[model samples]
Target: MKKVCWPYFDPEFDSLSERIYGPTCRVCIDNESLEDCTVVKVDSLNKQGLLLEVVQVLTDMNLIISKGYISSDAGWFMDVFHVKDADGNKLADQRVINYIQQAIGTTRDPPKPKAYTTGKPLEPEPHSERTTIEMTGTDRPGLFSEISAALADLHCNVVEAHAWSHNARLACVAYISDQSTDTPIEDHHRLAAIEDRLTTVLRATTSSATAGGNCTNQQQREAKSGGGGGTMTNVERRLHQLMLSVRDFDRPLAMMEVASEEGGKASVLIESCREKGYSIVTVQCRDRPRLMFDTVCTLTDMQYVIFHASVDSHDGYAFQEYFIRHVDGCALNTEGEKERVVKCLEAAIERRVCEGVRLELSAKQRVGLLSDITRVLRENGLAVVRADVATHGGKAVNAFYVRDISGNDVDMEFVESMRREMGPIDLAVRNEKSLMPPNTADHQRPRFSISDILKSKIERFSHNFVAIK
Candidate 1:
């Protein structure tokens, strides 16, 4: 047959083998075994959610899959996946099957679109005729309300308003309409009056009046220093402090040297702070070490310093004099730094309460459930005392302790509304006496009187101690 070439039997058979396998499906090649490959169909409407759920389930099952595809009509999704056990066999597991079923069940129908007519006249812009006042400064609380109230007092209509803050600063945009612009009150004069009022209010409301005044004066000085471009005024400072207290992530550091018996209590505090998302710089344990005040001052980045003598009388007056002497630019004198530190600590405390609430409800099936409870609390203007989430038997168990939860002065209807929003949450009123225990020997120390110290000092210095609950 004229020396017929038999490629199968020839030495060049390797080239033929490569050609045969070159066009193999990516799904089949990646899995390396045909038996490992699985093709599953999912509902197209909820494909994204189903895919995410399936991916999470697969990750848990130690399975690997390649790219997926959607079919025509957008009603079906096809996923090619495989599982690798210790033995390397690619087979679907019970978990994968359950996940697929769950995904299918959870698939939702696509939302229907509403028809809209064209060629209709657009609605006129709201508040176009109103006088707009643009206020810019470091973000803080009550600024918007105060501005609105001031406008109201001036017989001005607050047509539109919005407030935003960043890095301990606030800016507000408000539109006001006055009956007559020809009156003695011009926009600039009105703004100046409002600014003055805000400064007075900030100084009055602050726990540290001197510090508040100093901060206001600093802003004024800065404005004047810049040749009157006008820095953030008093209202802005208050608003900024409030915003920082509520949102900033920086936390005060708490350092302690506890015995092995007290270690557990300290751990609880550390865990509480962690739950609240406050950063813990350090936790040390030692027996009768030298009083190192600078270490705390350096590590904590605290402008104000305070030291509490341990419960054991043996560790007395550890580094108090050193701290008073060495630490310069103390918050006691620097008003801005004091307020910033106070606001930071307040944020930390709030974070702790939030964490406690979350820990108490850790057994809940969904995080959204807890979020709903918090939303309700915020809507009703109720202060959350403590929230804890704990898990038992693979289910989230939650407990909410709130202040003024009895609904005496608050509307019962609103309380019921909040209860409804919580959706089967275990809400409870906090017992104040139980939460705050009586002072022990540690509380009676002759060191710096925490209560006697000015609120500014306490607020500034408290950042060094981490709150557990």
Candidate 2:
């Protein structure tokens, strides 16, 4: 059986054991505590991947974590998060609060299995309105264009999609449906043909620089369920896992070393906390949404337990410090292991950073729309680096991050021409920038590294925890 990549972490706490022996998960939502953001405090019995669960729930709800303190050092977990809605205001909605309480609160029920029947012929997986197609392989110019054209040829309409490329690899999850029926594609033979065509496109060209060697059938089949039910899967998390599976982190040590101090790259420093038998990992990077989740998820998936951690952001830079040990309870004792952790964490953060100009298109939903748009982009010598496509109330809203085939800046004149050609479809360029360091020269204040205040923060919040060097 193929391993499940989504919901990468599974909690071991059963409802009966949780109540009796007591994980006693208590989630306290305090909107009164902070003026700028709501303070959410979670206390529970510590277990593997618990931090990720809390963060995942919050992120999935579209809550932004501005600051946080986490401690699970003494076999109990405590997390204090200062979070806000997308508009940068405290969570004020009663319905949202109630949902959070029910989700992570003490009386929360265990998650039910997410299985459903579509009652359709030749359904490989339970689905709803649309089928989801997930693909990953060596990234090359016009690759998405080819896939889009292929789907259009197969009479499939793309309703939503998201794609990410990193380290010469691409992973995409696209929600699609039948062009004629406007429903989930249920014909198994048809799905196999689509799958076969896409696989051929993926393997048509391979560059030696592509990570993970050659793209294989096993990699493609991991999440190829022919149903929109895959929408329930966390698209971003699945992309991270897919990239990780392809060994995106496995780069030449010399090349990896060069990235350690590069601009726009995450800087990771791993040290030992021998007294506590923990590895101290500190990451400093440009602040962005879900930064903490990416880091925590990577560590958890790598079999590391974060005993204590602090996440803070100021001046558009994020600072994270984690005291961690292996699942087997040993600190990173070798240089190679530490370097691997650094490279993996860096890859995780970089996975979601879109490259190039972002163009948002809003129009009435129609079959072959994506194919037409991608075809136009390819004709204009633009290559999609990343994209997000969705539909609401019969309106198709899509965002594509694209660059010139030669890796130059995208031309606005071509974009305008394409907009006119598409007719009535609202196409606008959205200024989407990657997480980049703030220009220090523009500000008079002296810049300080996370290390300058790391000691003070650790000393203040982690008195009960062991000291680190």
Best candidate according to lDDT: 2
Off by over 4 Å in 2: 1-23, 106-128, 206-223, 226-233, 251-262, 407-409, 438-469
Inter-residue clash pairs, candidate 2: none
Per-residue error (Å), model 1, residue 412: 3.0
TM-score of 1: 0.24
How many residue pairs in model 2 have overlapping backbones?
0
Candidate 1 lDDT tens digits, 243-282: 3433333321211122221221211011112232222222
TM-score of 2: 0.80
> For model 2, how does the per-residue alpha-carbon lDDT over 276-339 read when each residue is reduced to its tens digit?
7889999998888888889998998899999999999887889999999899988999999998
| Each model's lDDT | 0.33, 0.74
lDDT of 1: 0.33
> For candidate 2, which ten residues in a row score worst on lDDT?
115-124
- What does the lDDT read for residue 351 in candidate 2? 79
